[model samples]
Target: MSDPATNPPPAEGEERTSDASSTDETVAVVQAQEDEPNFTPITKDFGFLPIPKHLRHDPKHPAYFGLLLNATFGFAGTFVLANLYYCQPLLIQFSHTFNVSYDTVSRIPTLVQVGYAVGLLLISTLGDLVRRRPLIIMLVFICASLSIGLSFTTNFAVFQALCFLIGVFTVVPQILLPLAADLAPPERRATALSIVLSGLLLGILLARVLAGVIAQFVSWRVVYYLAFSVQYVVCVWLYLVLPDYPAKNKGATYFGLLWGMAKFAVTEPQLVQAVLISIPSAACYTNFWVTLTFLLGGPPYNYSTLVIGLFGLVGMVGVGLAPPLGRLIDSLVPWFASVIACVAYILTHVIMVGADGINVAAVVIVCIGIDVFRQMVQVSLTTAVFSLDPAARSRMNAIILISLFIGQIMGTAVGSEVYTQHGWRPAAALNLAWSGLMLFVVLARGPHVSRYTWVGWEGGLEVRKSKVTAQKRRDEEAGASDIQQRGDEKHALEAKQSVREEKDLQDATTVGMQEVKISETSEGEKQGEDQPPMVEVATLSAE
Candidate 1:
């Protein structure tokens, strides 16, 4: 049999009736191909369980990213980000296990934070260059493998190395944040981001609780083993439920993306302000948490790992403030929210200074206050940074997060040293100073910088209105310039087209006149053949 596509021409009496049917089939094939998703699947089937239709990947009718997906992002963010903080509460156990000094073991958490910053710089930026689902899955699997290595390692060097690697590969949360921002509806984006952020905060707080309780009952190694299991479980969950998000910058090189982050840090004023604000806030936050373990574990409190970890539960009250604060940031100007949070942060540190290690109630209050204010600052700054550029969210996130972890590293290394050598008051004082600096930055660079004389107190509602009015005027000016440029180009093209049409009409008139002259000559020749012709006249017109 011959192929229909290469069929011979029809005979003289035959009709060509197959063409329309074949054309329809060809169109259907093209439509089917167009409707297919342009991504590679990690697996052909959803693993181990039945996936709801809404949860499954469908290119034709994308499911709305609803509560279940939000919950998945939250839980996954919690577990993945928890890996960084797990060893904070277990610093004592690590010191005892490694047969090292407190200062020596303290480097573990610091190194982990440094490694995480490095990962934010290097790996997290790939979210813009590659499909996020596979990248996320790969990172989680690597992190799980590192966790198992951490569990089995007896050598301090090996443990530190494994911890660093775990931190480096545990950037899944950073990748997920941009994905959530991409999928979430604009009206509900803040709520969605808050949900995931809440999970991250919970992970940071709850990881300690979980690690402390487990390490208190069993070996510290068991904590790693448990983390390993949980990471893999979350990894599988992500694999099954996560939607495939195509890369935002498909052809971008990794190095180009890295360079773009540096450029963004320099160019985007909001991003720069947010990073500056977040660095110190993160340092102060890390200082309290890292040093709190030492303060509670020593003299007056003398708490065990389990008791110390339970304080993370107290921090949960702060985590509860995330969604509300997210909504607040959504309603208010983000920098204004940051200003309020900075004030709360400074007051919290003042309370910390008064606690003096003897007042457990004051310490608990400080914990809750720090957690709440820290959440506020983070959500506000992030909202501001994310608002700057949709296409560059991953890179912008990396810039801010790298700064954040750098601050964490500073806190871990410096806060621990300060607590060890100078005592709790000095460490608290240092954090107070950082908080003061944060407030200063916010005031100078926040809402009404031009009109405000000192710490934003000098400016009132009038200052705010003036600022808004000036901003509006500037925006209108920019829009007007853009419109003017487009209009100029359009006018130029229209003028050129007008000239070409006039030239064509002139040429057509000339051709029509020549034709009429020729016809008149021919008519005169015919008249001469019949009789003596006096004069032949012709009237010509061009349309």
Candidate 2:
């Protein structure tokens, strides 16, 4: 048979055929392009603005490039958020240079964090309302410029307001986190979140220490100058590497984004659960460190301020433990891991209560253990919220960060007062109480398991198992129906054969009776051969 596809074209010079000829030519060109073996199209829109490719993903099919780039962006988040914390250690330097009281200088860190809370409510909402890549770029540029302006300001009030602006602009980490979670494959989403969180943790741990050391060598103003330079560098790098992730709530107004977040907090049980866990967790973490600095600075140890900053190194174990523990959530129920974290917090605080009463080694070990567990819980809970509203991940993240910073700010305020009034032991007791509250929250927020939702199994596996079992049940029913139909056919065939056998038997019996009659008549004729009335006798017998 001739192939229609390969057949020769007809003559194309007809008067009315020019339009058809042109259409055929266009289709042929398109088909040829499609058939070319090595042509791959670029679908991502990075040139104009970010429109995130919410590409459908399977747990089994992984993309290594996406994973690696996600990590790179996560690393960038560390430097971006570090701008918020660089002012913390410089407070002492600021007080000495400006001839201000300690209480007056403390307002710097407070204002910055308060500004961060405000920014969480305002600027981070833009991640949901505008393109995240360009939004990040614009925010960081503003931060870098402000940091430079801050270094030149001699007036205390101006400097304090600049710190606030710095806080407001250094929310790039908040935006980066949700985007990373969205870009990650379904199975690796938790791990990706953990890695990004580790960046945040790294920035938190090092920011104060790096600033204190830098101020030790150079002037405190230089630290802000350096921050300005770092932010500029980060802005350029983000422009090159960070592709656009489109806004989820594209049509929402500024006020609407804020309203949506408030509504979620009120109506979403999961968001409330996340807040409960985060409050105690952040309170314990911040209260411990801030109080520990006081204890180590004043007690039998009598450590220096720089030495107090060095204690952040003990929590470096968290930077390593974060991702593995996040993967642990991939296997176990997240609530179970959170419960473990809360219990760890309680026990560590208990141990610290007695040990801080004694010596330093025991306290250091307890701090490390608590830091590790706290980071794990953070990763678990954040991953959970990211899933709660995939469409509103950035806004969900804004809520988490706002809760966390508020907890930290409150913890520091209350913890510093307690440390000044009572001592380290009483503050330890207070933290212990907080840990117990966290444990209760975890229990209350635990997931309810249905029959298909067996504990300690991946959710994807459970769904696949349900589908397989349903298909098997369908197959079994179909097989049973086929067996029933075959049995009915067999019974019908048996009934037909029985009817034919009965008729054949009746026919044979009739033939045998006819043969017997003929034989008997022949014998009678022989016996009455001489009799003339044989025919009349036979006729009478027949009658």
Candidate 3:
């Protein structure tokens, strides 16, 4: 006889069994999805691709394939976000081309960021509310159109308005970063985010370098033209080939989504503190980049745009190091990393304060240091925010990006106003203020809410309710309840046994009495019969 566990499956029944199991599993998955009221991931196909069911947005896909997809997203993000920074290096050129004051031209960068802030706030939440592919594609087309228009338009006012619109449309890449985090496996999510973020940082660096170099060879309008053409092609390819990932917040209305993000920013203390620290941190990074072009363009240094742009290449040293900083945030406590980063920020700012123009080496070294440390702080803080709510990853990211961009606006506005008016030293003083603010955010207090509430990773906010101790306490309570139940059962059994014994004893006594009465009656009957007959026992008793 074959053991049931070892028996081979029937060949014909295999298909039936597989089909039935798949059906049941699919139904169960649908039901489970319906039961969850909060944060249901969108899983339906766009009806565009006829690929196999398991391939699209399957978190269990091969790790290598996931990485490849992430890399694609990263590159896409780089190209899109590069639009924001290309104008930064071109500020001097814009001032010259438009025959405007440097101060007036500076508003172009600030307005672009302002549009970015508004767009980020408005469109950032769209990632969760709508289909990412169509939303992103729509934005791409608009950006492409705007880019082409910017290349041709001679009117400065129209060009300035287009800059804002360009900033709005370019946030497609911002949407993709949270998407990367969403699709990435939990074990590798941080690293995956870092890899994608590396593309973004590289784009920031190379946008200046490339813009500076390309503008030297041609006109700045060529930059927008190239971007427009390339983006149009990318948009088409993305529409045809990109896999659909549905929104988790598909049910939320537009107003509801934005309102919810605002609510999250206000309510979650970790998020609030994270934003606070990042504001100045962004101020520091953006101020340096925005002001550096001006500093190098003026004064004893009097560097050309190409040379100033090459300095962005030196900052590329920090770009390559970004992944390692992300890894550090993952491995170490994020709060600790943030504090150390804050210290580095302070020291770098001090170094910049001393560099009065002749010391190009100090400026270069300090700029590099500033980029690395500032990015580390950013990565650490961002990673810390992710721990607050995993289900709200997109919303959390929206909050984060919105907060950072707010700082971007601040930084750009400050750099444009202060550096153009009061010179570089006062600007450096503002950076020192940023560093001081970052340190205060780190060591001053913990979150008003709790930490370690979601992910188990260590962040700047470190509060965990003890799991092991709670388990032990629950076990003790259970043991005591079980002992009391058993004791009650034992007493009930003894009482039942005593009642059974008493019932049997009472039956025995009644039977004995009956037997004794029967014997006495028989003896009386015999005596009456012997004495002879008179109406039986009654007559005998009368006589």
Candidate 4:
């Protein structure tokens, strides 16, 4: 005999029993599977190529973000953003090549900026809705194709259209910034963002130098051809190395996401503050760069295109300072950084106003100061906003960048016009005015002491306390409800047990009465059987 727990084979007439037992076991297994919830991962493996085990990204896995991935993001962001500024130094060349006036050719950069803003609004938002690796690859490929069109086009209209398209698709940097923030550790997120931003700054500065040098010796068209090659290379690099990021907003519709962005702009005070500060900062930055071309190329300077482009090298100091500023933002409150940047912006513009393009030293100082301070402000604001909501980084980034590019468009259009019509002093003064407005807004709304009656610090504190109190009340209410429910459940269980006991007692009493009646009937039957034969015999004799 086998052990009963082993479920030994059925005996010769127990086939039905064996089959029924097996059927029950199968149903139990299936039911158990059905009870478990389905789970899907937020990050996916890179299927396009055989990515190394150490480079893969998964929240559960140990393949953490490291230096190599950071460098890859930096390089990819650099070249993709370089497409935007290549045409800046080539504006004069475009004028001659397309046989258009300088004023007409100047609109090309503005159109590019407008297209960039449109892309930030429409395309970059999709980063949250789709896998970022594929989206980024597609954008880079299209941008490379656009570069080819730009390289060969002679018609100004076609050239302008291609430039716009180039700007539209060159939003990979915007997408990468948020991706970097997502991948980096919490303590180092700001530093990671700054690394990518540093590359972008380098691209903006170096594209001018690269375009000017290539166009000076060779043709301006070569610049675009080179851009085309560099883009393709970056595309391949991204395909091989970039880890996959699954969609964050999986079930959301496109229009709904846009609407959500509008809501964020209005509802999130930190985001609103960042946007307001970034707009004027961006405007001033673009204003100075756009007008500097005119100021350097005319009057006392008469700088050639190459000479003008070389000035971008002076701004590299800002790129070098970005990482440290990011670390600073991580360690301290971002408000201090913003205040410092605003002060620097105001002072830089004041000096530019006084120098009036006659002092080369002053221009270089302005370049370094603006670039460094702009990085400070940008890194600080980005750290603040990204910290507000981790899930909405792409959309939040889109909002801030859309505003920034709008400011760029304004600066490019208005700065060129102002500098061309008036002199350097007026253009510098306009930048000064923007800086002043930025500082005023930062101080008024930022975390600072002000005599203004509308500061609302006390009100803000009260609102925070009220929110805390309300949350505590809700928790207490929930706890009370749970306790009441448990008590009700306990009372219901006791009532059910009492009813069952009463039912059992009634059944036991009825069984006892029936047993008693049966016993009595049996006794009567026995007595009658003992006396019945004699009575029947007497009746027969009498008859």
Candidate 5:
């Protein structure tokens, strides 16, 4: 995530920046990075510590057990919503099987996107207000059942409706992502969040590949059946194994919480920027995959669904490379990682736009680059959102997710229309435009971290620490440091001893007083001055 110019140069023949006609301001910035010493993150020491031994092995640590749970949940989430993507490359086959038009099969994916939009708005919104564990578990089970039911239906209409329902429940993974963030230690938060997000990225890419392979070997229905089984097991595991996260908005009603989230999101400039920037980047990422299938399936090569699926494995290489890139970013200069991620995304989409008609090998390379850039950007955004409000992490995440959902809908819609009218190039162009806009937001806004001001109880702790350190330094200068330390320690020890001695003395004093009272009562000494009076009173009562 180092600045692009600070990035290590390629071997001699690679294309470096060509800035003949560009504005002087941008050219100067680019040139400045190149002219400066090759400073990478390796020189910086601001990174988080490595994972600790106890946490590394502990099942309770989210990275260990939580990773598997999150990934399993991810598989199910993808199983539910990702199947909407199945008919993209396989539309021709689906058309033949269902005796429907190719365009009609296209509606299935579109409807799924619509369903996803609804889920993000409703289910994901509700996810933050309640106990996340039970809600996620319920969604997973419901989505799984629906997917399983999908395998049995021969009707396309039923299939589309089921896909929509699956989208509705697929918000569970999105819900759990913030939970993973919540569960992770602060130092390791980004890395853990990335691990869960990796599951999401893989699910998105792999669903296409897995579906293609299954459709080639067996019927498309078999794909849903497999998803249903995997999801059911994962759902059961999630219910049993995943712990419930208490809602942080404890005092607020559900409607109040939702209203607060909305109000805060719109008012916060950083959150607003996040939504605006993500809308397009997500659109690009979504559009690429959605359109790629159609282009590949209808061309000179006429690749089968399975072969198109194989290309998804290319994305795996990028996924593997991303963490290292992130590690590098984290190691870099303060406040530069996010900038690097954003810049990389912009360039990557530019490359993607021009990659059409390029050789398959070259296109694969570009796709991998795109994948790496996208993943890095996502990691940066995830880190940025959680940083905004650790307590409100879920709602903040929900906002970003909701934006991405909207982005998905727009991207899918535009890709569909553009592909129908112009071609893949137009879709790619649209994606690049969005990437450019994201870059503009990045440059204009600096980094999202800049706007964050520490608040709440921890902010009080920070203030106290600052004051304590300052007082200590002032005392040292005044020649009272040693004297104060001696007095503080002595006073603390004396307070402890005083408390113990007081308790012991009180116990002994109470015992002595009780013995004296008991002796007096036994002897009937209380009526000693009035012995004749007590005898006369008893006789009168008897008479």
Candidate 6:
């Protein structure tokens, strides 16, 4: 190519030179600017927003930030939920201690579930209205008191009632979950959420194990006392350290706040889908753990409560794998990885259904598989819901969580019935069926993007833009219609004023004309009368 920059060589070459010249000059300007300490654009005036000194975050200790949140909020909140289940391993012992039937003692856990469901809705809604930190502190103390009361109670009715109340306050875990996600940077959000959720699973598993050990050695009542003590200490620590954000539902009335969340949910389809998909999945996972203990304790292996509790130790493998899976979530396409994780969950159920005898190796492997899948899917679902609306994340969480609670209830009922009617194999088989159905739904429906998309996950910011093509056309038509309506109103007002002015001018003109005519006629009559009287007087003198 001839150097066309020096001279416009040919017609085609001239066009090429014109296009390339601006690009070359812009590159030169950028290079020149790089040499200077700070350079201004000098083109269309644009300035960067000022960076605040205090707003900056330290990136080095990202994991440490989440660990602090988990230790304070996760540890205490889960301790309460864990305590609800501490009665699980000791339910038989508790029934004997109180001289109650196994059926009557089972109501304790059911009461806790009802209380938990109510608490999640009540405390979460209030937390949306007020500061979360204070409520979390209060909830923990109240729950601790209930646990203490449960420890001292000899009365079955009173104990069951307090157990329900403990469930009501156990929602501190729900509050902690969203807070962890809020506190974490974008890349770390899934990891942070997973870590906190792992605490939830850990509490469920360890509560049984710890209770079994305590009941075996000390006494079942001592388990509640120990949990109550831990909760009180954690309540104090969390009140001191947990960060508070501005209320999500500020200035909204009780009914109005709930209605607003409902409105947003109906308008947003992705939220609806995420919650729907989570229901079956959560049900299956919860049923697996609850039923597993009962099966192991009853069968040919006939394990003790402590031996059954040790099975939960294998769940540590699932928690350990969370960070790696969270990292992979970023690397892979979301729906693809989600589908894979769901498959793992479905397969684990297959392994569990086939488990018989002591089968220690098979059971551990199955539990690990199930836990890993549970953590991964949960992380993905949270990502999807939070991705939909950054501003309304708390409410979105509340809506999805209601489904999880409902799922828990269903799971508990199914596990109890299946174990009683059809043995461990059939019960585990039913869980597998639940997982398979959920997997099929996920694959068939696929991942969805909303009309509104969020950006800046790391910094927790959202910039709304119109995505649907018809939106611009609709906006233009609305603007034009508004202008036309205003114009028509202005013209109608002007026409009415013009008619009034015309009528007033006509009345004034008519009055002036009548006065002039009257004056002229009077002058003419006086002249005529004077002339005739003068003529008559002259004729009389002549006579």
* Cα lDDT of model 6 by residue, 276-355, tens digit: 66787778877877787777887667888667767788888876786677767644445555677889888888888877
C-alpha lDDT of residue 319 in model 2: 83
Model 1 local distance difference test score: 0.77
Model 4, C-alpha of 84: deviation from truth (Å): 1.3
lDDT of each: 0.77, 0.72, 0.71, 0.77, 0.64, 0.68
- Clashing pairs for model 5 are 41-331, 41-332
Name model 5 segments beyond 4 Å from true. 1-100, 293-306, 325-335, 353-355, 413-430, 448-543
Candidate 1 lDDT tens digits, 372-476: 888888877776667566668889989888888778778877888998999999999999999998888876664644421233343343323224545656787
TM-score per model over all chains: 0.72, 0.72, 0.72, 0.72, 0.66, 0.67
lDDT of 5 by residue, 1-543 (tens): 223212453343444442221111212222343455752212111134222232231211122233455455545555555655655556666777778997788777667767776777667766556656557766877877888777888787887788788776677767877776665433344555565676677777777777777787778778778887877888666644565444455466777767767886877666776777778877887788777778678765577766767778888876567546645543432135556766777676666667664546645766786777777767767766665665566677778888887887788888789977998777778877888887777555543123643211111222122243355457665677678788899999999999999999999999999999999897786667547677789999999
| Candidate 4 lDDT, 174-238, residue by residue in tens | 99998887766555666778888999998987787888788889999999899999999999888
Q: What lDDT score goes with residue 518 in model 3?
A: 100
Clash count for candidate 5 is 2
By summed lDDT, the worst window of 10 consecutive residues in model 5 runs over 454-463
Best by lDDT: 4
Q: In model 1, what is the error at residue 157, expressed in angstroms?
A: 4.6
In Å, residue 154's CA in model 2 sits off its true spot by 2.8
Which of 3 and 6 is the better model by lDDT?
Answer: 3
lDDT of 1 at 439: 82
Relative to the unseen true structure, what is the C-alpha lDDT of residue 388 in candidate 1, on a scale of 0 to 100?
60
TM-score of 2: 0.72
